[model samples]
Target: MARVIALVIVLPVRLVWDALGYCLKQLWRWVLAPIGRALGWLIHHLIVIPLRFLWEWVFVPVGRALWWVIDLLVVTPLKWLWGWVLFPVLKALWWVVDLLVVTPLGWLWRYVLAPVGRAVGAALAWAWDVAGRISRAVGRALGWVLWNLIGRPLAWTYRVILTPVGHWLRTWVWAPVASVARAVRAAAREVRVALFGGPR
Candidate 1:
């Protein structure tokens, strides 16, 4: 009973809701969709197409003509002026400089400076060789003086005086002292053995 009552109650409401939804779908598909498409077509034809045509045909040609005029009037003349006038003037100035200044300087370098430089270099080399010889002779003389004054005398003293004194100390003083110490040690050992009654 409860199920039958619920079915009866819900059936009309469901049918009304589905009818409203179907009506809304049909309205969107027929009316709103066509209106939107018409508006899109109007915008494309009126605004977009005219702008594209103007950009392609009018504006591009005008810009290209302006650039060509600027190139012909300004840039070409400047390039010709630099190539024909300024370049030759600068080249002639360079030639004058080469004739007046560079040739004279070269002559001075070859004639005067070359011989002077060679003579100076030869003199310096000769002086350096003399200085080396003098330094070597002085070093040899110094070495000879040091050997005679200090080294030979010290060697003689070590060989003659020190060696004999060391030998005498070792033989006379060390040997006698060692002998006396041995005798005292032996006597002490004998006395200790007799007093303690131990076998030696």
Candidate 2:
């Protein structure tokens, strides 16, 4: 009786549990798993594949074509223009400047300014020579005056006054001092000879 009662109670609960499990499995298999797989496939095909194709076929080629066009149209032309037109134009402008401005300036310097400068230099040289001659003449005159007035008087005073005074000092003062020094030296030598008994 107890086993029959337990079976009656547990059988309905187990059946309900199994029915719930079955419903979960059916929902996962039919709905959720299919939706997830479909979403993955759609993302791969629509977004990833198309983006890859476009990148490989469209974008890379388009970028390369743009680079080629830029090289052909812009870069090449600019290089050519710089090499052919602009460089030649600059060279011609420089030549024109040399011909028009520099050459004329050089000619002017050579013909007009140079001759004027030479003439001015010659005049300055002549003036310098004349000034030098005048300075020499003044110097000579001053020298002549100095010789007659100052030099001659100095010479005469040296000859008459200073020479006589020097001669008197030499004769009176120097001669007596020299005689006294010789006498003292002789006395010293005689005393030394007497004391030491050596030849005088």
Q: Which candidate's TM-score is highest? A: 1
**True lDDT of residue 1, candidate 2:** 100
Give one digit per residue, the lDDT tens place, for model 2 in 1-200.
99999999999999999999999999999999999999999999999999999999999999999999999999999999999999999999999999999999999999999999999999999999999999999999999999999999999999999999999999999999999999999999899988998864
lDDT of 1 by residue, 1-200 (tens): 99999999999999999999999999999999999999999999999999999999999999999999999999999999989999999999999999999999999999999999999999999999999999999999999999999999999999999999999999999999999999999999999988997784
* Highest lDDT scorer: 2
All candidates: TM-score: 0.58, 0.51
Error of 1 at 123 (Å): 1.7
In candidate 1, clashing pairs total 0
> Which residue pairs in candidate 2 have backbone atoms (N, alpha carbon, C) closer than 3 angstroms, thus clashing?
none
- Candidate 1 clashes between residue pairs 3 or more apart in a chain or in different chains: none
